[model samples]
Target: MSKFTLRFNTIAAALALSGLFATNLAVAEDIRVISSGGFAQAYKNLASAYEKSSSDKLISGWGPSMGTTTNAIPVRMARGENIDVVIMVGDSLDTLMKEGKLVAGSKVVLANSLIACAVKTGNAKPDISTVEGLKQAFLQARTVAYSDSASGEYIKHQLMKKLGIAEQMQGKAAQIPATPVGEIIAHGEADFGCQQRSELLPVAGIDIVGLLPQEVQLSTPFSAAIVSGSKVQKNAQALLDFLSSEKNAGVIAETGLEPVAAKK
Candidate 1:
């Protein structure tokens, strides 16, 4: 071949290779999502669907309790984790936005879940339908377990106070150190366990008692947002979009969470 022709062919091949590389880079950017345990299972279902439908983006690590074993998602952000997106208690996300950890105006309300009690699948499901019924159930249990998360915190302080039984519950009620609340109940370590409805439903060997009555039921709205300095903003936003969709909302509802009143 002529020298000039050889040079032209090499240049053409180099340009082609560069174009392919860029295309792959664009398509392979996966969204990094950190979320609370309540939404993990439902979000995983949606992530699978989204990934199957897209070529330019993927949903990556769905970190349920991403901060670590000890810290909440907000605390994780304060500790300098590079989270592209976070799904957490809505109000907590608001505080993070105010503190400049998350991008302002980027919050998306995803779903809401309420706290409920569960017992081992074969155990008699206690009636906690009314305020008095709840008190009776609490009094009857040999050991009750709740977590350190939002729902657990509320039960420890608010519910016990409402029933005027904080002092009485001091020894009988235990603050659970970690999750799988239902699993704890299943093992008979706790006569009853309480946590967000979604988190409790999928756990093995537990039967969920109905949600707390309206007078005492606690509903927590969960929201999502991208971190202000995330380099993977595009990928993160794609994840947010998928999670906020109506189709995914149905899946969330089926999994025991209520859909958010409005999308962001």
Candidate 2:
């Protein structure tokens, strides 16, 4: 072969290999996040944007009681699962901080949630305009539902007792196990169910009633933190920052969660 031809072929091979390397680099790094039902939808939405802007894949592991209000970080830590980031209740994060599971400086409240009620799609939307109306609706519900998670526990301990229906709701009210609380209503197995606003929005076949009245509402702040000794510390922090940004607030609101306002 001619020397000129040999040089051209060698240059072509070098360019092709370099192009392959560049393509691989353009793909994002996959980072695993452990989150509970409350912030799952919001975080998933933020993950899409983060992946596009930063070359890293956001992998989320969702648990019903795993990171939910009642169980929080302790369950995951006990289970010994590999988690890069945790998104759960603020109180739960504080517990982890006490245990040194979450890095101290990395914790941030991403969103706050209010409990809301849901019914099967196409069902008559119950009147929850007033506390009295909500009380009536709860009493009238043939089979009410609530979670065994944080919000559920609150409903049982505080709300029901306050409403004077803890005994009335005893046998008729269904306590959902590990499944999504909204699922029970969506499947027509329960007349009504309550869960975090963010959790109910993503679920299909369920229509959300507005949040509980302010007087009776339960607001649970959802926070995120990088787990201590996480391998992908930078990537996990990026995901948390992205979720906490103003740009992501729209999605957060759409999912039935309110973004934590920036402190002055």
Compared with the true structure, all predictions reach lDDT values of 0.80, 0.81
Give the runs in model 1 whose Cα sits over 4 Å from its true position. Answer: 1-26, 56-71, 261-264
Candidate 1 C-alpha error for residue 191, in Å: 0.8
Report the number of the highest-lDDT candidate: 2
* C-alpha RMSD for every candidate: 4.7, 5.9
Best by TM-score: 1
lDDT of 2 by residue, 92-199 (tens): 678888888888899988888899998999988888878888888899999998886678878888999878888988888876766787888888889888988888
**Model 1: per-residue lDDT, tens digit, 63-147?**
3342345456766676787668888888778888899988888898888889889998888888999999888888889899987
Provide backbone clash counts, one per model: 0, 5
